[model samples]
Target chain A: MIRVVAGFFIVMVMISAATVYSLKETTQQLKAHKQQLSADILKDRAAIKVLRAEMAYLSQPARLEKLSRRFLALSPARADQMAKSVTSIAGRENFKQVAFPVDEFPLLLPQEKPVFRKKTVIRQPRVRKAGFYDRISLKLEKNE
Target chain B: MRSADLHIEGAKSGALEVARTRLIVPVSLFVFGFSLLLVRLVSIGLFEDISDRVTRRASAKTEIIRERVDILDRNGVVMATNLPAPSLAVRPSLITDPQEVADRIVRLLPDLNRTRVLNKLTSSRHFLYIKRNLTPTQVWKINALGYPGLVLEQAEKRVYPQGRLASHVLGYVDMDNKPQAGVEKFFDDHLSNPERSNDPLYLSIDVRLQYIMREELERAMDKFSARAAAGIIMNVNSGEILAMTSLPDFDGNGAIDPLAPEMKNRNILEPYEMGSGFKTFTVAMALDSGSVKLTDEFDATKPLKVGRRTIHDDHAKKRFLNVPEIYTFSSNIGASLVIRQVGIEVQKDYLERFGLFDKPVIELTGLSRPILPTHWGEIQSMTVSYGHGIAVTPLNMVTAIASVINGGRLIPATLIRKNKGENITSSNDYPQVISPATSRKMRQLMRLAVEKGTGSFARVEGYRVGGKTGTAEKVVNGVYDRTRKITSFVGAFPMDRPQYIVFALFDEPHGTADTFNMATGGWVAAPVVGQVIRRIGPLLGVKPVMDVKTEYQNLILAGNEKK
Candidate 1:
C-alpha cells in the first residue's frame, strides 16, 4: 500500500511539471512569433509609404501634363466635346447607328471603323563570302 | 503484589497510545496536502481560461507607434506623409579607428562632408551625429561595416511628394515634427494627437485645379511681366476654396526663408486696394437698399467733386448712365453717384454685412487685416465705393462676391473639405447678406459687364462668363503712382445660376505686345480668368448650353422695362 500511494503521488507531480513545462515553451514560441509578425507589419507599412510617395511623385500634374503633351494626342476635354445624349451623338452625319443584340453581351462601337492594311515584307541581303572572323561574328549576331 | 501488576499494565497502554497518535497525524497531513495539489491541477488544466490572456500578451507589443497624420487633397491624394528613416550617430570615445570609419561613411553617403565626419569622429566628445534620415540601403551598408562606435536610431521624415504644387496650402513640417505654416500650423494639435493620427486630414483643395490655375497664372505672369500674381477659384454656393495659387511659390520639401518674397501667400495674406472690384459691392448694396434701381441713371458726364477730392472715370461715358451701363463701363463717377443715393450709413452697413469690416475668417493663419480709412466721411465713402480708400485681401473679395452671386447667403469660406451628406443649409450658419432678387440682378450686371464692357476679354465660348474688371493705380509713397498699377478681374460663370467664382489679380504688370501696350485689368487679368475658366469648366463638370442669349433674356427684359 505504501509503495502504491508513493507511486501515485510521484506520477501526479511529474504530470504537473510536464504541463508547466509545455505551457512555458508554447508561450515562448508564441512570443517569438508575435515579434516576427510585428516586424513584418512594420516592414509592410514602410513599403506602402514608399510606394504611395512614388505614385504621387509620378502622377504629378505638371509631369503628367508634360508627358501627355509629348507622347499622347489627348488633351483636356472641352465643354463642346461632350454630347448631351446618345441620340444627339447618333444624329451626327458621320455616326453609324447599330442596334443592340438581345442574345449577346453589349459591345461599344468605335466612332470610325478600324481599317486593315497589308503588312509590308522586308527584303533580305544577298549572301557573300566571309573570313573566319566574319563567319564567327555572323554566328554570334544570329544567336543574339 | 496487585499494585505492581497495575503499574506495568498502565505503562504498556501509554506506549500504544503514543504510537497511534504519531501514525494518524502524519497520514492525515499527507492526504490533505495531496488533495489540495490535485484540486489546483484540475482547475488549471480543465477550467481556467487563458486563450484571451495569451492573445493579449502576443499582441501587446504590436501596437502602432503613431506619428503625425497625413494631409490629403479632396480626391484622397496624399499631399504629405511620414516615412520611417534611419539616423546614423557615432560615439567618439568608442570608435577604435576614426580615420577608417570616416572613410567608410563618406563612401557610403557621398553627400556627407568627409572632413566634417573625420572631425566629429576624432573629437573628444562622447557622442556625435554623422547624418540623419538616411535611406535603408545606406543604413544597411553602414551597419555591414560593423563599426562599434556607429549607432543607428529609428526616425521618421516628413515628405511632400507634390513638391511645390500646393506648397502654400500644405505648408511644411520641421525636422522636429513641428508645424510651420498654412494648414500645418493651423491644425497642429489635431494632427499630432496619437489616437487620431491614423486618420488623414482632407482639404477642400483639388490639386488638379490648383495646378491648372497656377499654370495659367504663371503663363499670364510671364507674358505680361507682372511683379506678382494671385488667383482663387471657389464654390460660390458652399464657399469652399477649390483652388488657390500665389506665384513665386516655394517647394514644401525644401528649406524656405520665412521672409522671402516667394514665401508670401499673395492670395490671402497680401491686401490690395482691389480698385473697381469693390464696385460690385456698391451696386449690390445700391439695389438691395431699394434706393437705386437698375434703371436709375447717374451722371457720369463730368468729374464729381466731394470734399476737395475729384472722382473721375477712367473711361468716361460723358452722359447720364443707368446702373447697368455704369457697371459695364466701370465708371468711378457713376459708382460714387450710385453709392451717394444709397447713403453713407447704408453703404457702411452693407460693407459690414459683407464681412468687409473685419478680416475674412478661414482655416489659415497670418490673415491680412483690411486696411480701412481712419476717418469715415464723404471722400472716404466715395473712394471706398470705387475701391480706393479701403483695402481688403483677395480672399475677402472672393468670399463677399461668392455670397452676392450665390443667392445672397453669406457662407463662410472653408479650407476643410465637407463630408458627404453634410447639410450646409440646415444649420442656419450662413446669414442673408442681401435679398435674393438683388443677387440675381448682380449676376446679370456682371454678365452684362463681361459681355459688353471692359470685361469682354473674359468671355469664354459656350461657358456664359460674367465678371467685372478693375485697374487701380497702386498707392506709392502716399501718392497714386500711375506707372504702377494693380489690375484684377472678379467673375462668376453660368450667368443664369452662378455656381463658381473666379478672381485673378496682377501686380504692376507691364503691357505686352498682344495687349496693345496696355496693362489694364481688361487687357491683362481678364484673359487669365477667361483661359482658366475655359480649361477648368470641363474639369468642374459645368455643362455648357449653347444658347446663352436666351439665358440673358431676363436681364434684357428688365432693362427695357424702364427704358
Candidate 2:
C-alpha cells in the first residue's frame, strides 16, 4: 500500500510539472508574438513618417514650377481671368459655354473667342498652389 | 498463536512510528513549496497580467524618453521633422584589425577619412563614433561588413523637407538637436519637452505664398543684379505673416556660408530708414488726428530745409498738392509740410502708438531695435515724416501698414498658426490707433497712389492695388550714397476691402532696361509687388473684381493707371 501511494504521488507531481512546462512555453510564445507585432507597428509608423516627408518634398513649389514651365505653355493666371461671381459673366446661356481669357480685360471686352471646352469651366483657386494644371478636368453636369 | 500475532503487530506499529518520524517534516515542506509554485504559475499563466505590466513598463522606459515635435506650415504641411538616423560606432577593444576595418569603412563612406577611422579604432577608449547621420543604405552597407565591434546606435536628425523655401524662418538645428535660429529657436522649449512634444507646431506661414514671393524676389535680384532683397505677404485682418523671404537665403540642410551672409534675414533683423514708406504713416497720422483733410493743400514748390539737411523729393511734384496728391506723388516736401500741420507731438505719439519705438516682438530671435532719434526736434520729425531720420525694420513697417489698412486696429504680427475656431476678430477693448473713417481714406489714398502716382507699376489690371513706394539712398559714412539705393514698395490689394499686404524691397539694385536706368522703388519694387499679387492672388482665394476704374472712379486720379 505504501509503495502504491508513493507511485500515485510521483504520477501526480509529474502531471503537474508537465502542465506548468506547457503553460510556460505558451506564455513565452505569446510574449514573442506581442513583441513582433509591436516591432511591426513601430516600423509602420516610421514608414508613414518618411512617406509624409517624401510627399511634401515631391510637391515642393520649385519643382512644380519647373515642371509647369517645361510642360505647359500657359502663363500665370492674370487678374482678368478671374471674376468675383458667376453673374460677372456675359449671360446665363454662356455660363456653360467656354469662357476664353481675352488678351486684356476679358471681363470688359465682348467674348472674342472660345478658348476652352463647352462642357467644363476653368477656374483657378485663389488660395494654395497644389500645382497640377493638366488635362485632368472634373465633369460637373448642372441640374436643370 | 495469539502470542505470535501480538509479536507481528508490535513490530508493524514500531516500524510505522519510525517511518512517520523520518518523513513528516520533509513531506510537509515539499508540499508547501509545490503549492507556492502552482500558485505563481496560475497567477502568471491564467491571469496573463504580468506580461502586460512588463510591456507597459518597457515602453514607458524606452519610447517616452525624448522626442522633438514637428514644425508645420499653416496648411498642415510638414516643414520640419525629426527622424531616427542610426549612426555607426565601434568598440575599439573588440576591433580585431584596425587597418582592415578602416579600409572597409572608407570604401563605404568616402567622406569619412580612413586615417581618422584607424585612429579611432586604435584608441584606448572602449567606444567611439565612426560616423553620424548614416543613411539607410550606408547603414545596410556597414552592417553587411559583419564586424563584431561595429554597431549602429540610434540617433535623431532634424530635416527641413522644404529645403531653402523657408530657410531663414525655419533656421538650422545643431547635431545635439538644439535649434540655432528662426522658429526652431523661438519655440525650442515647447518643441523639446517630452511631455508636450507630441503635438506638431504650426506656423502662420503659407508655403505656397512663400514660394511665390521668394521666386519673385529672386527674379528681381537676378534681373537688377541686386545685393539682396526682402519681401513679405501678410493677412491684413489677422496679422498673420503668410510669406516672408530674404534673398541669398541658404538651404537649412547644408552648412551655411559665412561669407555669403544670406542666412541673415534682413526683414526682421535689419532696420532701415524705410524712406518714403514712412510717408504713409505721416499722412495717416495727419488724417487720424483730424489735422488734415482729403482736400487740404500743401505747397511743394521747393525742398524744405530742416536744420542742415534739406528734405527733397527725387521726382518733385513742383506744385500745390492736396493730401491725396502728397501721398500719390510721394512728395517729401508735401510730407514734411503735413507733419508741421499735424505738429511734432502728435507725430511722436502716433509713431509710438504704431509700436515703432520698441523691438519687434515675434517668434524669431535676433530682432534688432528701431533706431530712435536722440534728439526729437522739428528737423527730425520732418525727415522722419518722409522716412529718413528714424529707422525701423521692414516687419514693423508692414505691421503698422496692416493696422492702418485692416480697420485701424494695431494687431501685432504673429508667426503661430491660429486655429479655425480661434477668435480672429480684433477685441473691442483693443485701442483704436486710427478711426475707421481715417482707415477708409488711407486705403483710398493708397489705391490712388498706385493709380496716379509713383506706385503706378504696382497696379494690376483688375485688382485695385493700394500702396506707397520708398526709394532711400543708402547712407555711406554718414552721407547719403546716390549710387546705391534701397527701393521698397508696400501695398495691399483690392483696396476697397484690403485683405493682404505685400511688401518688396531690394538692396542696391542696379538700373535695368525695363526700369529705364532708374533704380527707384516704383521701377523695381512696384513691379515685384504687382507680379506677386497677380500670381498669388488666385491661390489666396482672392477674387479680382472687374471694373477697377468705374468702381473707384472717384479714387482713380490718372488715366495711365488703367491696365
Candidate 3:
C-alpha cells in the first residue's frame, strides 16, 4: 500500500509539473509576441510620422504652384466660371443659343446664294438561301 | 499448545509495529513536501499576480514619449512635427585609434571639422557627443562601421516641413527643446504636456490663403520697393484670422535670430498711424451717433485751422462735400468736420468701444497697444478723425473695421479655431458697436468709395469690394516726414453682406512707373487688397453675386451720387 501511494504521488506530481511547464512556455511565447507587436506598432507610428512630414513638404503651395505652372494648363477660377444656380447657367446657355439663331445667320448676311447638290442613296446587299453543299464549300474556302 | 500461540502473536504484533513506523515517516515527508509545493503554486497564481507585473512592464516599454505636440493648420496640415533623430556619441577610453576614427567620421560628414573632431575623440573625458541629430544616411553609415564605442542615442527633433511658409505663426523649437516665439511660446505648457502631446494644436490659419496673401504681398513689396509690408485677412463675422503675414520672414526650420527686425510680427506688434483706414471708423462713428446723417454736408472748401494745425484733404474737392463725398473723396477736412460735430467725448467713447483703446486679443506674443495722444483735446480729436495722431497696429485696424462692416458687432480677434457653436450671435463677448441700420449706411458709403472714389482701384468687378484708402506721413524724430509715407487699405467684400476683411500696408513705398510716380494708398495698397480679394474670394467659397442691386447703386439712381 505504501509503494502504491508513493507511485500515485509521483504520477500526480509529474502531470502537474508537465502542465505548469507547458503553461509557462506558452505564456513566455505569448509575452514575446506581444512585445513584438508593440515594437511593430511603434515602428509603424514613426514611419507614419515621417511619411506625413514628407507629404506636407511635397504639397506646399509654392511647390505645387511651380509644378502646376510647369505641367498643367489650369488657371485660377474666375467669378464668370461659377454660376449661382443650374437654372441661371442653363438660361445663359439658352441665351447664347438665341443670340446666334441658325436661321438668322444667312438672313443677317443675305449676300451668298445657296449651293445645290444631287442626293446619293446607299444600296443594301440582297440575301439568298444556300444549300448544304454551298455552305460546306464556303466553310472549306474559309478554312483555306 | 496455548503457550506456543501467544509467542507467535506477540512476534507478529512487533513486526507490524515496525512496518507501520517506517511507512509513517515516508508518508509524512511526502505530505510536507507536496503541501509546500502546492502552497507555492497557489501563491504564485493568486497572491503574487505575475501576469499583472508582466503587463505593466510591457505597457511601460511600449509607451511613446514625445518632446512636443504637432502644430497644424485649420485644414489639418502638419505645420510642425517631431522627427526621430539618432545622435552620435563616443567613449574616448574605448577607442584604440582616435585619428583614424575621426578621419572616417569627418569623411562621412563633410561639414564637421577634422581637427575639432579628433580633439574631441582624443580628449581625456570619459564620454562625449560627436554630433546630435544625424541624418538617416549618416546613422546608417555609422551603424555599418560597427564601432561598439560609438553609440547612437535616440532623440526627437522638431522640424517644420513647410519651410518659410507661415514662419512667424509657427515659430521654432530650439535644440534645447525650448519654445522660442509665436504660437509655440504662447502655448508652451499645453504643447509640452505629456498627457496631451499626442493631440495636435490647430490654428485658425488656412495655408492656401496664407500662401496667396504672402505671394501677392511679396510681389507688391518688390514692385513698389517698399521698406516693409504687412497683410491680414480675417473672417468678419467670427473674427478668425485666416491669414496674417509680414514680409522678409525667416524659415521656421532654419537658424533664426529672435531679435532680428524680420522676426517682428508687424501685424500685431507694430503700431502705425493707419491714415484714412481710420476714416471708416470716423464715418461709422458719425452715422451711428444719430447726430450726423449720410446727406449731412461737411465743408472741404478750404484748409480748416484747429489750434496750430491745419487739416487739408489730399484729394481736395474744394466744395461743400456731403457725407458720401467726404468718404468717397477721402477729404481730411471733411472727416475732421464730421468728427467735430460728433464731439470729442462721443469719439473717444466710440473708439474705445471699437477696442482701439487696448491691445487686440490674439494668440501671439508681443501685441502692441495703440498709441493715443496724451491730452484729449480738440486738435487731437480733429487729427484722429482722419487717422493721424492715434497709431494702431494692423490687427486692431482690421478688427475694428471688421466690426463696422460685419453689421456693427465688435467680435474679438482670435488665432484659435472657435468651436462650431461659438459665433458672434451666440457669444456675448462681442459688443454692439453701431446700430445695424447705421452699419448698412456705412457699407453703402464704403461701396460708393470703391465704386467712384479714392478706393476705385480696389474694386473687383463681380465681388463688390468696398474699402477706404489711407496715406499717412510717417513721423521721423518727432516730426512728420513728407518723403516717408505709410500707405494702407482696409476693405471687405461682397459689400452687400461683408464676410472677410482684407488689410494691406506698405511702409515707405516708393512710387513705381506704372503708378505715375504716385506712392499714395490708392496707388500702392488698394491694388494689393484688390488682387488678394480676387484670388482668395473663390478659395473662401464666397459666391460672386453678379448683377445684385446694392444700396449704393440705388442711391446713385436716386441722383444722390456724391462723387
lDDT of 1: 0.83
lDDT of 3 by residue, B1-563 (tens): 65324433565888876776678766886897689789979986786646755664655464566668888887778889888888899998888888899889999988899999988888899889889989999999999988787889878888988888798888777886788888988999888887887788989888888999999899999999998999999999888988999987898777788789889889988899999888899989998887888778777779999888888789887878778778888889989999989999999999999999999889888889999999989999989999999999999999999889888888988888776567547425678898888889888888888888898889886798999999999999999999999999988998988989999999999998899989999999999999999998877767788776556454433434444
> What residue pairs clash in candidate 2, if any at all?
A126-B538, A126-B539, A126-B540, A126-B541, A127-B539, A127-B540, A127-B541
Please report, as a residue range, the 10-residue window in candidate 3 chain B with the lowest summed lDDT: B554-563
Which candidate would rank higher by lDDT, 2 or 3? 3
TM-score of 1: 0.80
TM-score for each predicted model, relative to the true structure: 0.80, 0.80, 0.82
Model 2: how far is A117 from its true place, Å? 43
Candidate whose TM-score is highest: 3
Per residue, candidate 1 scores C-alpha lDDT tens digits across B448-514 of 8898789999989878899999889998999999989999999789888887888999999999788
Stretches > 4 Å off in candidate 3: A1-21, A91-144, B1-64, B552-563
lDDT score at residue B544, model 2, on the 0-100 scale: 82
For model 3, the local distance difference test gives 0.84
**Per-prediction RMSD in angstroms?**
15.4, 13.3, 17.4
After superposition, candidate 2 runs with Cα above 4 Å error: A1-36, A71-76, A93-144, B1-65, B257-260, B421-423, B548-563
